[model samples]
Target: MIEPTAEPAVEARGLTKRFGSKLAVGGLDLRIEKGTVFGFIGPNGAGKSTTIRMLMGLLPMNGGDATVMGIDVRQRPEAVRRCVGYVPEQHLIYRWMRVKEVLWFCRQLHEAWNESLARELCQQFELSGQTKVRHLSKGMLAKLALIIALAPEPELLILDEPMAGLDPIIREEFLETVLQSFCRGGRTIFFSTHMLGDIQRLADSVGIIHDGRLLVHGSVADLLSRTKRVRLALERDELPAELPQGVIRTWRNRRECVLTITDCDSQKVQHLEDAAQVRVVEVLDVGLEDIFKDYIKGQREAI
Candidate 1:
């Protein structure tokens, strides 16, 4: 059975990493609850990979602590590795190893390896035992990597941009495998990706990172319920210095103003309308991608 607990699947406190003059990750503190599919979204070079590498113990943390499956990752990386499966953005396996030889080597490392599942996954991914790792296409290599990770039946799975370069069809195939196998087993999945649609389809929770910091983190449903895009048609051309409550950002042209706001509900919108003496033209629902873009737009535009 999947063995998550009250202690959380993953936790990091004040985790920091630096490269000489540059700070790659800056004091990130976050948690992933048991049995969750948590999506990590960030802009390019936002330190997503650095953070994941630190968590997996592949790289050292410049400061702070991280734990996976209740074990200190920095101190007990083997313990953490035993319980977690990782799919990186690119293939990292030895190219000279034959497909089955690689599988055999991986199988010997973990006590929990399941041969039946491995066999089944090979079939699902259309991989053959005779093919060398170098011969496998990118999509097939991804499948191979995923199968190796899953065969150990890890309680937590970490995927860092696992779909990065795959064409749409291959991406769909990989996503389907994750949904059917990992999600079905109650394993906690923490994956970082630029593909917001993947998060929309698979994540129970979402966290957005920008400039080495988490801008927002929460349950996807709750976040969606709390934020909105609003348009107001006002009698006055000039907006009041003190704008309506809940506004995050606002844009105005003549008699109309568009606002992005949080904690937005029917009551809040009604109150804004009544207080401002303006007509509420539209209250639009937005998906995760819109929210992600909105959060980063200001940070980028500032420069």
Candidate 2:
């Protein structure tokens, strides 16, 4: 288990936001420790972006509070911005300016901008300083946005779907760059995305949100360990009218039944077998993607 430290890099308590009668985010409580790569995942319009914007002080909350790098977002938003780097889904840079000019302009805005780091990143990304932003490809544009965020050298980096539209190769490169360059010296990352592969690869911890509510938050290993797929072969070619406890979802045909379950253990499995009156054929590990799908599906069914 990953132990949390006393002080968290980011913390939110009862964070709430609303658009007219629509509640975008509701009572979201979260904590991300320093140096941890935390993935915030949800489907589209699941309040992932709304929560992030509130945390970044770019959006006003209807209720509750948040702190980024130990600075209160409501009271000291500018201070929080200074201590955190943010990369929104859209790259809103000046397309008319050259890459070097863009860097220069942004440098003047930030007190702790690292020119050396920015130059190094430009070289690594093969971004020519003289090239205009409009001339850069989608991949290059994405790299530039990342470069701008990292060059600030903030304690916390908040990314809102940073890899949303990139091709497979560029996405791989982006993840690798983040892993190698930014995940050092105890810098924290709060990454928001619907990509299960990215979360599995990059995040130490994960939080899943659905309909403005956080469904689960924990270490990746712990979640995977506790969630499993149990295959059962029944003597009778029929399933029980009611599912066993802890089973989130189930699929069956004839004598075969596959169960998706949570909080799984030897005792739980034994109970399930006894309760369902079925013979256990195999207990299989569940992947992050399947787990995510099950969670979302379960929530949708409940609604």
Candidate 3:
């Protein structure tokens, strides 16, 4: 059972990271509830990886504090590591170690290691004990990282670009495993990815970071319900080319006009239709990708 109002499994209060003259992450605050799939979306070099590293205590934060599983990550990095599992964007396992040896080594270090769970995971992922880590394909390597991280059953799992460099079939399998096995037991997942569709499908909440700052963070339903794409099928071509106020994006397709309206009520769409007097065919759902593009475009225009 999830503990509502429980202390966050992972908490960041005004976290900031800098590199000389550049600010990598600027005053970010985040709270990851227990037993949730929280997705982080941002382009490469947008500070997602930097933020993760800081949270993991691989890098020190310039300001603010981070706690993982109620332990201060900066002050007690090793203690936090004991309760947290991290899979980096790049594979970092020993290439010469066979799969069985690596698992055995992990079991030795992690106090919470469950041998039965490890063996079951190896079977589920189709990883052979005799296979050397160097001989495993990229997909297999990714799965192996996941297994190692999860065998100890850490309270918080941090995955950076976990789906990167994976084939389609492997990606699906990986996601299914995460949703079915990992989340089933009420573990919290902090996953970063550029795959908007997966985020939409898997995340209970999402945080969108852009250019070293957080743009928005909320539940998926709140974003979709708050942002909508208003599409109208015109009876004539006399409609105004200019979009209504609050419309972030507009597209015209010969007798039809599509407008992406932000933070508006459903009644607002009816008002727009009445003002235009156009036959409204349908109001299409706005996707996260389109919303992200429009947000970036608007930011560019503002500058």
Candidate 4:
């Protein structure tokens, strides 16, 4: 297990962005500790990419400040880029360049480029250095992009939907390679994706964003432990006038209702049972995916 440090690899304060009249990201504050695998999760067009771009200093923020590897992103973007490896959502490489040529070109840019690591990664991914970038398949392109990012031996890696579109087998293989090669070193990884399963598998901490706002951020264990699904078999056909305090969403039938709640415990359950006079059928632990869904659903309802 990778233990995080006191110093943050990435930190943002009241980060905001707007495109003319449209708000892309708004008042977002985030912190990612060193050596921690932090997953940035949200639905498509929920400002995940926008936030990442701002952090990478690729896009200018309209409000707030941020730092990457303790280098002020706004003032020293190039310095931040030097220390951070980023794989964008789109694989934007020269299509005409051969694999080896691409590697050589990137090697010239980064002072910390590791040739042996690059070669090893290429071999592991079954990439032929002779092949042109245009001829590579989608999975191969993804692999090549990752190889480029990893070859720099960066302190922090920021991946924006790196596994967006791939077969399950290929995705699993890619994730395994990432775990073996990158994560074992205790380097910080900040990746954004809508895939909950990937987040669950890769992240020690997760931040959920919706419609340009963060819903919650915490460790995976804390999230799973705090959020629960309470199944109740109601004594009568009707629900109580007021639901439980932490209830985010509720599903009901004639005789039963399931409450999706946060910060749930025995006391809260007992209180609900006493107030509503409903029998507690079960208090089940919720999965990460379900928890994410419930948060998203609750946010949508609020909007």
Highest lDDT against the true fold, candidate:
4
Q: What digit string (tens of lDDT, one per residue) describes model 1 on residues 1-303?
A: 324467998999999999998999999998998888999999999989999999999899999999888999989987887888999877799899999999999999998999999999999888999999998888899889999988998889999999888899989998998887765666889999989888988888898888898878888887787889888888788554455565656767889887777778777676667755475558988777777777787557555
Candidate 4 vs. true structure, TM-score: 0.93
Cα lDDT of model 3 by residue, 57-104, tens digit: 889899999988899988998888788888899879989999999988
Decide which is better by TM-score, 1 or 3: 1
Give the TM-scores of the predictions, in the order they appear: 0.91, 0.92, 0.85, 0.93
What lDDT does candidate 2 reach at residue 162? 92
RMSD of each: 2.6, 2.2, 3.6, 1.8
Winner on TM-score between 1 and 4 is: 4
Please rank every candidate by TM-score, starting with the best.
Answer: 4, 2, 1, 3
Better of 2 and 3 by TM-score: 2
Worst 10 residues of 2 by lDDT: 272-281
Clashing pairs in 1: none
Best by TM-score: 4
Error of 1 at 104 (Å): 1.3
